[model samples]
Target: MKLILIRHGESEANFANYWTGWLDVDLTEKGVQQAREAGRRIKKANLAIDCAYESMLKRSIKTAQLVLEEAEASFVPEFKTWRLNERHYGALVGKNKTEMTQQFGKEQVQKWRRGFDEVPPLAKENYFDRRYDGFDRRLLPKGESLRMTSERVLTLWQDQIVPRLKSGQTVLVCGHGNSLRALIQYLEQIPVDKVDEIDVPNATPILYTFDSLLRIERRIEL
Candidate 1:
């Protein structure tokens, strides 16, 4: 079985150099091209994905569509859920990273961004969104540390992704940096301290091949 994980192409927030947590934004022109190139890469690899998954966010959803379209596999099944959404940055949402560093000092901001258990200052309340109407209140977090994000992400992984892989199906997961990182950390058994160093670049695919027992046989950037 094969699983490919790709982060969405750079968003307006990413281009503007700001923190974006659940900040639904679309792709820029460069982002579109990047996504297309990612598709070409996958196509060249001759991967025949059976099922695809993405976050409800437009960036992720759009990236997945573009990938499949370019790969000439638009017919593949797609599943979108909030469970694949990025970690909530709380009050930091929309805040500029450089400016935050200036205000809070480098180390503190680094901890907030990379430390496993370091949660950011909480947001006032969950934003009203129809997509999350039936979501569990606890899962709709004010702010999430890596540990917090991992818990919910792992739950979805077990419930949705594992079974398909166990049946020898290929899967493509399109998501954000932290969400994919959480998944990668689990799949590769990355230690919390080192996991922060692993990045999911925009529109780049990381492919994982698995054995019958579902252990990763090989992982590479495609």
Candidate 2:
């Protein structure tokens, strides 16, 4: 079994330096080209992609579609789940990073961005915070830290991805950087502190192979 993890291409928010968690934005023109290039590259590699999963987000969906087109495997099953969205930056959606740094100070911003357990204050639009809206906010609520993100992704792996791998299905996941980072952190057994250092470039894919017992054979950048 093999699992391929990919990040979506550069989004307009990426060019604008805005926090885009659950914002439902689309890919930019350059992003489209990048997606095509990613597709072409994946096609050239000729990996046996059996099935796929993506975030409900459009950029990831589009990237997955483009990659599948390149791979000539558009007929494969593709599942979308909100569990794979990027780390939601509370109260920072649509804000400019440079301006944010000027106002909040770079150190504080960096802590919020890169710290493993530190989650930013909740978004003003708590309605947008689907993870914690109506389900007893005081107890067993869910907005995610990077650590929490890892936990969620690992649960998804255990419940969804791993079973398919054990069944000898080659799966692909197209997800956000932080979400995918969370997955990689667990998949590779990397330490919490070092997880943030794993830079997942846009549209880049990470491939992992598994043996009969579902232990990882190797993880490679493809």
Candidate 3:
């Protein structure tokens, strides 16, 4: 079975260089162009996807839709799951990255951005704080480290995604940077410390094929 993973296109937040976590912003013109290109690339590759999955966020949904449309396969089965959403950046949802770098120092911001087990502190009762309400209250209140994100993603994979893969379905997962990283960690069995080093760029599709034994036979960055 083969699985294709994709990241959403650029967003307004991406253009403004702000933190976008559960912000629900739409894609920019450049983002749409990127998605269109992704669609073209996928179509050219002649990959026939059987199943599609995306984050609840519209950015991922739009990307999936455009890609499928370009591939002439929009009629395929697809589902959405909150488990595939971006890593919640807590209090820093709309904060300016430059200002954050100036205030907290670039090193600190970088640490929070890329640290495997560390999480930025949540805002004190704000929009970003409330975004986690749907999740387990206890886990939400405490905030989530990337390690924790990986654990949650693993739960979803073991309980849901793996079953579909075991049934010989080719899956396409559209999601954000950190959440996708979590999925990669689960699929590739990468050490938590090194997970941040895998840079999955915006709108790029990664394809992985597994043998009947469920071992990876090919992993291609398409």
Best candidate according to TM-score: 1
Compared with the true structure, all predictions reach lDDT values of: 0.91, 0.82, 0.81
Candidates in order: C-alpha RMSD to true structure: 1.0, 2.9, 2.4
Tens-digit lDDT track for model 1 on 1-222?
899999999889899999888989899989999999999999999998898999989999999999998888899999998888998898999899999999999999989888888999999987857887887777588999988988988888999899999988999999999999999989999999997798889999999999998898999999
Where is model 1 more than 4 Å wrong at Cα?
A: none
* lDDT-superior candidate, 1 or 2: 1
Model 3 bad stretches (over 4 Å): 126-142
Order by lDDT, highest first:
1, 2, 3
Q: What is the Å distance of residue 195 in model 3 from its true position?
A: 2.3
CA lDDT for candidate 3: 0.81
TM-score, model 1 to reference: 0.97
Q: Residue 174 lDDT in model 2?
A: 93
lDDT, model 1, position 33: 90
| Candidate 2: residue pairs that collide | none
| TM-score of each predicted structure versus truth | 0.97, 0.90, 0.90
Better of 1 and 2 by TM-score: 1
Cα-based RMSD of candidate 1: 1.0
- Report the number of backbone clashes for model 1: 0
RMSD, model 3, all Cα superposed?
A: 2.4
